[model samples]
Target: MPVPPLPNAFLIRPIAHRALHDGNRTRAENGRLAVEAAIARGYGIEIDVQPSADGDAMVFHDYDLGRVTTATGAIRQRSADALANVSYRTGEVGIPTLAQICDQIAGRVPLLIEIKDQDGMMGSDIGTLGSSVAKVLRDYEGPLAVMSFNPHAVAEMRDLLPDVPRGLTTSDFPKKDWLLLSDARRAELASLDKVEAVGASFISHKITALDHPPVLALKERGIPVLCWTVKSAAQEIKARKVAQNITFEGYLPA
Candidate 1:
């Protein structure tokens, strides 16, 4: 099989952050309303994928279902069918499967699927979850990329679906762990798994103050960069001054 060209979305467009649920009126994170809204607005969709206890792949952002759904147990503890009826915080939206999500926006918009491994929740299995996603999305015939904070999971994805582009997530965000871990540790993780690129996730304020010269320095070498969750035109302007690849949340590109 030939390696297809990547989607040229970031060339000059902004992405819709988790389907534009719009101010928590609906469910937050990767819910139906947010995704649908993103499709309608003509922006790329960013959603998370996690393994169901039944070994199915579902669209969800958390290992624990309580925060986003009616269920209160770990996702690995419940089967996909059990989660089917559990409504998301966005009113009546239920957990969605890979098939359901792909079916909804297969051709409408590009997708960024985050394969989370927070607690190594894919269970004791290694390639099963990653390969499962690979098979399901093999014929998807749409623009997509697999991302994760876990380089090992991303590596598994690389093996399972070598055609799919992979991205690594990091905490440049004004968070506790970033302060706890040295920049050296962060750089070490960034260099893992023969990763093609990186997404620099940080608060808007922190981004402006970031070592811009070094950040774009990566992009200069053909390694594209994506900054996380910028919700304002001002922040976008600031990012444009340094890194052109800035991620946004429902904020219009003025």
Candidate 2:
């Protein structure tokens, strides 16, 4: 497949998700090794960042560190230095900070950061998601973009720090028919035109319901489509079957 040129493209077409995490890498999901893999493989890397309860910026995905780290409590409860004590099981991966990620990866790859909001999740104590993101990325030096499922957070990012690139993530992961968007809501976000005004330079959509009508329509307009959660060879095949490229765990095959 021919890799389309991304206008103002900083890096290559393919992006590494949560950094490169094959064996010999750390046991953590979002870590320096994963970002290193993306850079070593000559692609971009995507990650999630949110604030701790004390208002320091950190690089983490879950509302809590249950899955990826040895930590048991909500990450918000932990400080940046404290979170560093939590390591990967098999490999020693101290939880990294946003500043650490940016400082270490300077100009290496595009840092796609998702600012986690506490809109609906229970026990989520992420205080002021947008401002926290703004405070951290203020000094980052490299290709970077911000994205979120919450459009309001995206809007907040725009208002707080207007220069950063942003994108939207959706699971249009299910079949379109199964989706329950109303006519007006669908017309606005489900279409490509409205997506332009959403401050999204590119968008990440899940792969379960690949080649969906609306997603394809977005691609036809020159907007880059990034497929996600591609974990295995089979999932990679399915995601690649529909979109130009993808971000995945384990490895970047192409």
Candidate 3:
């Protein structure tokens, strides 16, 4: 079956990166408070998911818990119940499950979810995290889409949630930043060779790499292009020359 069209709602609103986070000064990234803040302000919300030890999808970023939480270990090492009890260093809320986030949003606004790569190196070693996300969103009735930096993970979502729109989170794959990927792998990813095979409906490319040939080519073919982490109004202005929408943070898009 063909992937559903990328909804205009996703293109019309400035998506709040990790839900309008402010360096964790008040609302922590992916925290319940942040999500509520985004909804209150009328922006689409984008969040990442990582699987818990028990194969439940948890709405938190980072493979490790040390950065955002007082806890100190791999997030995948803990059970969903244990993760729900873990405290965030920046706020009072515990880690949220995907189900919890879905109920929180309740279709009030469009949701864009990025499935954080469990394969570590963007390989084919996936299934658990993707399946967990699929299970949680199976009955969700809302305007939403799923994507991943890992094409294999996106492919998994393609099979698991055939009715849901899917996309690729893409980048230039610079060697210095992507040390885990080999030269061949980086070239292949940069080329976006798997986009057609995986059936991506859109692409959220790295903001700085929006002009990359393959991304522009996809845009020429009428693909809706979204860019990530645009931190300021000026960057948003420049990114809009190529991107149809943005995933932004820091200052609010006007």
Candidate 4:
């Protein structure tokens, strides 16, 4: 099957990283408030999902609850209901399920869903996160896509939801930053050897590494290049030299 193209809505609008979250403010990342804020501003919403203990997809950025919530443990250790009731220290809102977030968006704007790497080593040992995300997105009607830093997860989505557009979250994979990944693994990922095999329609690469040779090579082939965490307008300008769109936070795009 041919790779599906990303919707123009996604390519045109600046995607808000973790929604329009303001860090432990009343509008927490991936919370309903953040989703609403992004919707109101007409920015594309970006969120991360991981499977709960019950195999339900939860919209959250961290594998652990320590950063955003009062609790401190692996998010997967909690059930869906338990997770839903755990409030953010600032927002007083519980974490939401993928289903709830989708229903909230209701096709308001483009949605980019990142499936957080469940495999600790970014290898083939993935959990049910992909399947869990697929179940919620199967019936969803919107301009949406799924991606992952782990190629294995993207491959899983290809088999489970062939019709939805998917991509890989690419990075330069600096050794000190990614100590969990061995040199061989980082080398393979940096080369982007899995793009075609995983059926990725686009790549959300690191903003700083937009100049990476493989990423530029993919763009030369007409593959869409999206970049992550562009914090300021200056970064956006630099990233746009190669990236077709951006996932941004900390500052609004003009």
Candidate 5:
């Protein structure tokens, strides 16, 4: 099948911007404040999903808990019920489940769900993060799509949730931290060389890397490119010039 179109909307609502406070006070990813903020603003929500120990798809970003929550260790170590009770450093918000987020939004706007991978960038079972997310989103009726850096996860979503659009999230290969890996290994992990094999309907690329040859090649083939984490008007301007849509936060698009 032809690649599905990117969300018709131009501005995608990133979960990071979902906070009542504008700047520094914004809570971490996948919180009530952030989800509500995006919903109230009438913007499509972009969220990350990882599975809890008990197999619930939890809306969170980091693999570790220390950065955003009062807890420590891998987020996967906690059950959804335990995570729900954990508070943010600000002490008002707790992590939410994908179901809760969907209910709160109630199809008010589009949703871009990024299924985070487990260790080794590929998950192992029904308990795998991607599988759990697919299970939760199975019945969701709304404007939604699932994308991921892990092509395997994207392919699994393709099989598990065929109706939902799926895309590949790509960044520059051999990301600074992966310089030690073989060039072939880094390229494989980046997904730039395997978009068709993974069955991606679109591409969510790192904004700064939009000019990369693979990205430009994908755009040339009429594939929609959605860029991420655009924070400033200048960056948005540059991103818009290259990408069909943008996932933005920090400030509203002009």
Candidate 6:
């Protein structure tokens, strides 16, 4: 199937919020900074979702809480209420639920939600995160879409939230703390070999891997290729040459 068109000309990924907010050294994935970026810059925002211990879909990035919060341990170990008390390293914002984020944005701009499910660690219910987010989005009248590096999660969202768009997040499998998967597993995730089976409507690829054959092939087939984390004007220039859109952070793109 051909990929669907993006709701916006470009997306402002949450990671860029820190740079846009006077170079705040704290995390940028979720909370007020991201909402500010979206509302102030008039760019669509990308958010990552993870389920809390009580199964509420939370707007967060890492599976573990140590990086962003003063608390430690996997995020799934805490209920939404518990996570709410946990402050970010900045000490101003606590972990916000997906509902809170939606309320904050209030359909002001498009939302690109990236579901962060890995190997079913969050829950046995394959659709837990998608279903949770769907419930919150049920009455929302904004342009939004669900995406995931895990294709299974994406498919679940497609089934439960048929009206919303879906995409697959891909990368060159860079070795990072969040990417604990082995090279073989990373390759499988990045290859897009099972995209047809997953039924992804579009792709959010790593900026450096936009030229990979699978990505190029998808672009040729009219799948909208959106690249991520373009940190500078120079990188944005390069990525825009090949990608249909960009999910950028760190600096404003020209």
Q: TM-scores, in order shown?
A: 0.81, 0.80, 0.98, 0.98, 0.89, 0.86
Residue-level lDDT tens digits of model 6 in 97-213: 999988888887777888886565322346467789889988887778778877788777767777677888887676683356777777777679866776777888888878898
- Stretches off by above 4 angstroms in model 5 are 1-5, 10-26, 121-127, 179-181, 189-191
Q: Give the candidate order by descending lDDT.
A: 4, 3, 5, 6, 2, 1
Per-residue lDDT of candidate 4, residues 20-75 (tens digit): 98876777888899999999999999999988889999999898999999888999
lDDT of 1 by residue, 1-254 (tens): 33333457643456666666575556466777777877777777777788888788888777788866666988877888888888766676568888788889876777877777644432224535676688788888767777776666766766677677766654443335455545665555533323443222211113544454444445566555666677898878776665555567756664
RMSD, one per candidate, in order: 4.4, 5.3, 0.9, 0.8, 2.7, 3.3
Better of 1 and 4 by lDDT: 4
Task: Give candidate 4's total backbone clashes.
Answer: 0
Q: Per-residue lDDT of 145-250 in model 5, one digit per residue for the tens?
A: 8898777788888778777888987888645755555777677666486688767878889888889888888889888888887888898889888887888777
lDDT of 4 at 6: 84
lDDT for 228 in candidate 2 is 80
Better of 2 and 5 by lDDT: 5
Q: Model 2 compared with the native: what TM-score?
A: 0.80
Give one digit per residue, the lDDT tens place, for model 2 in 1-254: 12223335433456667677664335455787766767777777778886776777788788877776666889988887787888765466577888788887897767778787666421124358678778878877767788776566766666676777776776542236425545554455444443555566667787774566777877777677777878777777777766667777775566
lDDT of 3 by residue, 1-254 (tens): 68678889999999999998888877889989999999999999999999899999999989999998989999999999999889888866589999999999999999999999878789999858898899889999988999999999999988999889999999999999899999999999999878888989999999989989999999999989999989999999999999999999999997
The runs of at least 3 residues in candidate 1 whose Cα sits more than 4 Å from the true structure, single-residue gaps closed, are 1-5, 118-127, 172-175, 178-187, 190-214
Name the TM-score of candidate 6. Answer: 0.86
Clash totals for all models, in order? 3, 3, 0, 0, 1, 0
lDDT of residue 37 for candidate 5: 74
Give the TM-score comparing model 5 with the true structure, all chains together: 0.89
User: Following a full C-alpha superposition, what root-mean-square deviation does model 4 have from the true structure?
Assistant: 0.8
